[model samples]
Target: METTRYSVPFSPLQERIAREAPQLSAALNHLLQAMGASDFEKYINSLSALKKVDDHLLLITKKEMYRSVLTGRFLPVIKECFAVKFVRIVSQ
Candidate 1:
């Protein structure tokens, strides 16, 4: 993969969103400690107990340490979603 450097200062949200995986993994580890042991049940309960985890882990994160690791290269995923939406419309 080709790496391009961004010259602008990154905002907290931007950085956090960027480094979601590791920050989330870290967050999950912390959450796991609260849940005690790991399993699907713990996962589900954590989701329910920590609403932000879903959105933050999957979306939000003011923590920027994980930013460099994430690539917001989900354009293809967005394109696929748009295509699927179009198909659904045509079928309807």
Candidate 2:
């Protein structure tokens, strides 16, 4: 008997995210470095761009503390960097 292997394809949202994640990550790293926020730079790896709505980008972090810090302090900078009118950070 021969067994067949199945592969799962990425959904449209996943595909779009996969394509844009690298650029976002790079931009975030650059911004962090430019702002001299080396202490916060490591947290970049913990963030993920979940979705893009009209003029808004949804971001998720592993912890509520990260979400709070990002929303309170970095939201404006992140919005400017991503050229978005609004950014929402959520903890998962």
Candidate 3:
């Protein structure tokens, strides 16, 4: 079995906030709400117009980001997230 992992690059805004802030939970929550209300999904859906990705891993990566934020743990969280999110698991 070959697994392919696709890494979704974070928006510059998201990365900046995550790296610099300790309390962005509320910000993310609000941002998500705003995105939903404004039909942001359509914009997100267009990212992979050039290619297809695994939605499951995309979600896992997002969860990993939240976990990292909540725990304030770096390194492994970031590493695992990069690996899981960007590294396509291709099993042959």
Indicate which candidate wins on lDDT.
2
**Worst window of 10 by summed lDDT in candidate 3:** 43-52
Clashing pairs in 1: 19-66, 19-67
Candidate 3 regions off by >4 Å? Answer: 1-11, 37-92
Clashes of each: 2, 0, 12
Q: State the C-alpha lDDT per candidate.
A: 0.30, 0.63, 0.35
Best prediction by TM-score: 2
Please write out the lDDT profile of model 1 over residues 1-92, one tens digit for every residue. Answer: 99988785443332342355343344444433543453312222222122132222232223332222121332223224222221100100
Model 3: per-residue Cα lDDT over 1-92, one tens digit each: 99999997745334444555435434334544545633323322222211113422222223333434423433233224333334221111
TM-score, per-candidate, Cα-based: 0.24, 0.60, 0.24
Where in model 2 is the C-alpha error above 4 Å? 1-26, 50-54
TM-score of 3: 0.24
Least accurate 10 contiguous residues by lDDT in model 1: 83-92
